[model samples]
Target chain A: MSCLGERLTALVDGELGHEERDRALAHLAGCARCRAEADELRQIKGRLRGLSRLPASDGADDLPTDDFLTRLRSLAEPAAPAAPDDASGTRPAHPGTLGGQSTRPMRQPVRGAGPGRPRDNRPAGRAVASAGSGALRRHQRRYLVVGAATLFLGLGAASYAAGGRQEAPAVTPAFDRFAVEHALTSGDTPMTDPLTDPVNQIQTSPGP
Target chain B: MTRYTGTGRARRRALVAGGLAGALAFAGTVTGDAGPARGVRSDPGAVGLLRAAADAARRVPYEGRRFLTTWNRGRSATAEVAVTHRPGEGVRYRASSGAEGYRPDSAADESAGIVAATLGLLARNYSVSRVADARACGRAAHVVEARRPGGGTAGRFWIDSETGLMLYRELIDATGRRVVATGFTEIDLDVPAAGPRITLRPAPPARGADRPDPDMVDAQAAALAPWGERLDGARLARLRSEGWPIPKDLPGRLTLYDARSDGATVHLSYSDGLAAVSVFVQRGSLDEARLPGWQKTVRRGRTVYRREALRRWAISSGNGYVSTVLTDVPQSTAEAVALDLPRGGVPFWTRLARGARRLGSAANPFG
Candidate 1:
């Protein structure tokens, strides 16, 4: 394998046989620019881990910056073995450069593949950010709706309870009137001797 | 001769003066007036006569044996009553006859006892109105009607004009039915000072009895059971907590003591004022019995109900449950207490049957 190819394979496996590994390490040790490049890759990996733990986006605004990196990685990986130099030349020197004007075009290929991959299938970091943003927007809408409903319910319950209390006076007067009318109109006679009523002989008569 | 003639003239003058004095004395005695009396001989008003007769009857103590014959279609039922009056102890009586042979020793007889007792109580409280007068029994009788103050059944008395005796009495039910009638066929006034004889014996002490059986004492309570159970401690506690005053006393309270066994079950109760105790045994059916002049009263709300009132205050038994509020209490209070009583807790069919039996055997003194 070429020297860069051997070094890339070793990096993927995280291992190298000792003598060749020593020679490759010595080349890296002397090369400040390569060391800087390796450092950038390490930073990229760290950023990917952080993105993986991001809340899934539920709305558009919460999409993560790492989404662009994912598209760049996908595009660069396909051409990486054939033209390693060309792929390396396209990469930004620093992670912050991914958000600048030069890296914008790198987002195009993945966007174009959107039809086959579906928006959420792109990569774990980007999908999660999209899911989280969408969820946050939905939560805001729900809070507004719930707050309005609770206020209306509270007002209704208060009115209903008040109405029940108010009715007591209105109802009691009618009952008083009824009682008075009954007392006045009912022709109640004092109970008399049953024997006085000749018709009631059957009732008054002593039974054998 | 001259001296003798002067003496004769003197004697004649004395005679004339004595005759004038005697005439004045006679006039005074006849007019019931030492001074000149006027209009003392006029006839009294019908109302006045009635008042007088009522007063006289109140003062007299008399008793008699009464036989009442009820004829419906071709059938006739006869009941015999022996009544007695004491000066302060009140009237007491016992009634017996062959017509109600089915209830040999039934509460029916107690009905007469109650009627007689009520009459005696009425005698103490009666005041004949000077406004009402009516003819009854072919005599110019005074008509007096006494009504309960709050509203309840009233009694009317027709007193004889000449004798000041009670010739007839009647009880007017709430439905305006003359449900009970009683009158004298033959009355003896100035009945020999000897009180009238009574043949009634105190009901034999019930079997194994030292005092009246508790069940017998509260038979009305037992009959009211299941319904009475609703007035348990929990409900009473609720009432108390609700600021409803439980009535501890009321005027002219009448209590019914009853015990009935429907072959399988026994019921007993002691009722006073609006409160009644009840005990029930064995399941029973409930059917409404026909009461004379009874009218159905419907009250609506959380509990929809139809009740029949014998009088305004006396509710008829229905659906194995017999209930009533003591008429003496406020209607609202009575209704509250009644509502608190358990609903349909009574075995309606059985209680209804018992009620019918009670009414059937009731000895109506007015009758």
Candidate 2:
């Protein structure tokens, strides 16, 4: 990548600042090697999500769900290679710009593609991993989906229950009584307001 | 007492009264009769005419169609009521929709549209003056205008020339816009002088007599019910000790002129003399979901449900008490008064407990 290094990964993760993201995208449009690398990074990121579908099994009580997600996430971080000079040299001098990991090693290319070589034609690693695990991974994914749905439905029911009111009887105000009471002291004739009293059919109009 | 027509002996008597009123206007002898009638033009003649109008409202027998219209936020609510008044028996109002209501003579102070107490307040707050003679409902009327300190007309009243009865009244806001107006569209003198007394007796409904018209039964029941337990200073102080929000004054210079209770609810009446507001307080949380068609608003974290009609209604609830503020004033004034009333706040623990109880009730089928 002549003009971009960790910035390519940051762009794929959508973590770059607006201006820095624009610059990285502009460089990717002209550089074929960086474009291939961006495509490869996207593929690996997709496979990582597929692997994350595995439920944190209670059988391995030591591994919590958050820890499992963190380990799965670690698989996508790639080393930031030394960037060659760009035409304008506007790239940030700090390797850690945009929160990208610069000290890591380059990710191992899956499906036997060599490092630094384009792996566009290789089958996604998700497919290879699923094929190896067979029905076991499928069962774990089904359990994860069912657990998530149950959690969602249970929380919704609990919230509805919390919202239910008690202690006070449902009261619809006696508006007719209220009107007369208001008039008795308001110096108007002690009578109900025809408009406020639902029983009266006085036509109310808008003012200019 | 002899009943006379407009051009008969009554007109001569009215002319003589007018001359006397004009003489009083010039002499200013009745200046402090009600209160300090201080303004640019403090005409006690106008005050006497208004006081006479209040007395005539009860002393004169008349039947007419009166319309009340209130304006708020570029919208208006109007009500046309057919009214019948007797000397001893009070006014009976029949709405256009055929709904009937009764106000017994005892239930009303019969100070016309301006109660005696408020007349004093009006005099204290505005300068009362007899402006001119105007015509209303095809009858000659003496126009009385009350002006604010800044010389703006706060209110205007048109009193019948011959009978001294209030024919029309309108309240004007600080911005010179009419907030409320009520008056007779058409009137007929039943009898010139109040004549002999008449008693109103509810006709007994025979067994299975078609249920006696539910509306009439309701109206009769309302009339028969105890008007209200008038709250005096001692009682009001006791209520205050028990956490009732019985403030002697409210925003907009409205002072509490009357307080009453109907066992379960306390009604506090406030007025700046021209504009009146009533606040009703009851013990219970407001059933917000049941207030269908009401506009809900939250200001400064307080929720208020409001509705505008011939009058404005603003309801709010907190700390196990529900308060409803009703008035013919502007919507903003009603809302401000509703929000200004004291209501206890619910602490975090109380809220949590309430939530837990609700959850328990929901989980229990029998709850």
lDDT score, candidate 1, position B266? 30
> Residue by residue across A1-208, what tens digits does model 2's lDDT show?
4457656766776656688788888888988889999998888777755554454533233223332332343343223233333311333222221123322112222224322222221322342343245434654686799999998667556654554433454455555555656766676443535323542233221110
Most lDDT-accurate candidate: 2
lDDT of 1 at B183: 57
iRMSD in angstroms, per model: 19.0, 8.6
List ranges where model 1 is wrong by over 4 Å. A1-208, B1-59, B65-80, B88-140, B145-155, B160-166, B171-179, B192-367
DockQ of each: 0.01, 0.08
Off by over 4 Å in 2: A1-172, A189-208, B1-41, B110-114, B190-226, B344-367
Please, what is the TM-score per model?
0.27, 0.55
Per-residue accuracy of model 1 over B1-367 as CA lDDT, tens digit each: 8889899989999999999999988877775421221221212343344344434443555555444332222333333455444333233433332111001122222333323333333332332233367776556776766444334434566777566766665644444444434555444454544443322233432222132322243211111001112244454445334322233222223222333332222333323211222223222222233233333444543231222121112332222334433222223334443444333332333334444444445545554
Relative to the unseen true structure, what is the C-alpha lDDT of residue B208 in candidate 1, on a scale of 0 to 100?
20
